[model samples]
Target: MTRDGRRGEAADDPVDDATLALLLEVAGTPKPGNVDRRRDLDDLRFEAFLGGAVGARPGLERAARAADPGAPSVGDAFVRAVEGMAARAGTNTQFGCLLLLVPLVRAAADPDRELSPDALDAVCRATSVDDAVAFYRAFEAVDVAVDDPPPGADDLDVRRGSDAEPALRERRATLRDVLALSVDPTDPDRVADRNAAEWTEGFPRTFRAAEWILTDEGPLADRAARAFLGLLAAEPDTLVASTLGAEAAREASERAAALLGVDSEGPGGVGDVDAIPTDAVHGADLDTAESLAERFISEGINPGTTADLTCAALFVALRRGAEVAP
Candidate 1:
């Protein structure tokens, strides 16, 4: 992979798997409000996502080459990936996914360590203040919908992008520290930052959903679709909450839970239900899912965060030996 838009030689590589995961995630049909093979959003088309995936290969390769002395850090790789992705897509396509995948790809580069929560956590914990600055720079490369910063944290607003770099440097914030700001919110109404939570908390949802994708017996695309539904049902999408409201995000999850015939609520609260049963996911009512997809798109509700998590899960599954076959 080169900046000149030429692909490297094909071989067994985690970068290839990561790129495939992006394609499979977008290709999965009836992803409900996402641009999948069967449908496209008004502003974003399916082709852009394909171009984004192809364009992101250089950054993925950089992350996978962590052993190289000159390899970019996780945050630098992420910034490169987002810049490439936006350049090809003409907008943001997988910003959140690359945030998750960059560290995971770096963790996968360690021959002594398997791609696991602990491994990823170590990679995230090792990030420096420079990485935090790079992360903010990545945000400057594309438009990402994010909530306003908390009242006292105006200087740390992510939407400020690179403008906040001085504050981050002054505070000596690492990339993990920057993500931690979004993980535990003081305001009850603030939507949880699921991607940041994954970065700070070792990617629990991503790994769990990867297990769902691996255990389910089907085509890889169908497995990804099922995993996508399970993920959407399990949590209020952060993007939905930011774009719409918390109530709208919860309603979307509730509808997905209903389609899966599961309770959306549990002892913990909304989106704390048990793992969606494998049987239920495999036997899910596609007709109802399709109808829900139509309804969500019509209402301008897109579960973009869930889709990002699903793409990360697909990458994990692919790394763990989930094969794609006809």
Candidate 2:
């Protein structure tokens, strides 16, 4: 997309816009755990992520254009985009982000590029069984790290990948059906995520984050970083719970809350004395944040769900005409 207030100029094509969002998510400072522009995991480098974002751009655009009226379903677009990303990055860099973006892109593909919670809901609610099948195929394409299915869904374990395709067909489950398993009321302990919540319900958090990004006074990167911290403080990241235990996730949330000087599960607390922007306060906050990031990174605790939510927020801001810097 063109810089904000330049609506008269032709916006970046859908591919370019999606690519920029991916880059911005990884490039955000103090976005602990996940690979950013300055941090790299042993197997995943920042350069590889940039390549994966570039590689997935065309597929994301094609998915957007294909679903303008309706052709490729979100599931099909998701599988294709992840495949392209994996081929370039040689690892799973953006599978979770792609899950959120395929639907967002479809909703934004209208003549006006208008995206609302209702529009996103309609797009997801319209998913077909074929979309479910394609989603399973996408899971097979990459070894995505996910929480295990509940006892009831043991047969439909994602680790089985295409092996579960036969059962998915036998059950005639739609993409919505598959996602419902994650957030099912029967299995209260199952880890529900913002992505699955978006797929099953409307994307409440994603839309709210976007609104915060729009209203917050700062450059896009600062807004994104603060939003990331805000969300992390407010919610226990499901990815952390999935990889570690619930207690670890809770601790992570508490740490994030302390960083921003807010009560866990409370508001952003931007004006709190603990959150003041004094040089000493800022330095101590970064020191604390860096310490937490170092501990998580060393322990392999990646709050990926938080990262994915940030990407969805970035996508919304860009689609709604936020100015991005080079």
Candidate 3:
């Protein structure tokens, strides 16, 4: 529950380090525009894998239900698509793949509009290979940028061995393992690595990225929601007046806060708020997270709960296989 990384400027703004890695890789590959090139949204069958997981996210299933069977909302389409990815990969995952297909999901939901290219740009601007090389070069220009912590900086979060140099070697080892070949099969952090790898070959972006973004995060009732948002907010049309509105993400955020006995914004009729359990420390997978999520949805969703429902559904789809970090 400790805050991770720096403040993100905004949800659905641009790709963070994670998504950017996927995007830049896609852009460079033989199939940069493949997701876009697909003629129709439903024609893409990745939805079957998503199944109930998509239905579990906040707003996703309701949007699909509201839209008529052959038709689904952007949120609905995205969650289902991620479900499909998980099912196909033959593994458990939260389906963060939903993020990559955001443009496609929004486009499918909106018969009136095509998801814009800006979403892709948001990812590309951060990486794009050419930029990465420049970034590394820039880092080289700075002096005293040693991989190891200096004398007084031992208090830094970085782990060190007998001394700093050995620690740098260990750091490199971690990166290497995180970036290792697919013979072990589970790891693939950067984009360039996926293409060259033996096992991750020919898989959709959903499966490729979901390992870290969704599954590896560990399971806690809260994470299912985070995974869903990570994927849904990627949709081209998902960016709204504000991500902090009374939507699924906000509701999920509130639920997480309340569980921790923190402040939550809602009507005066406050219901029973469950205390965070000791086991929840192990995270979502260890908890009956999906069921708790369903309870959260039932209590919070009213007639006008379309947005919230869809968001939660998306969350379920993305985080299904993920776990909370220990």
Best by lDDT: 1
- Per-model RMSD to reference: 4.4, 4.5, 21.7
lDDT of 3 by residue, 1-326 (tens): 21222233332222122222222221211111011111112222223323323332332332323226554433333444344434443342223333233332332233333223342232223222222222122222221111222333342212221133343344442211221221122222111222112112222223322332343343332332332222222211111212223244344444444443334434211211122232332232313333443454344321111122222232223223222235
Please, what is the TM-score per model? 0.94, 0.87, 0.23
After TM-score superposition, what is the CA distance of residue 120 in candidate 3 from its true location, in Å?
Answer: 5.3
For candidate 1, the 10 contiguous residues with the lowest summed lDDT are: 2-11
TM-score-superior candidate, 2 or 3: 2
Hey, what RMSD does candidate 1 come out at?
4.4
C-alpha displacement of 207 in model 1, angstroms? 0.7
lDDT at residue 61 of model 1 (Cα atoms): 86
Per-residue CA lDDT of candidate 2, range 21-126, in tens? 7888888766778777668988888888788897787669767784345566777788889889999988889888888888888877755545788878878888
**Scored by CA lDDT, what does every candidate get?**
0.85, 0.73, 0.28
Q: Best by TM-score, which number?
A: 1
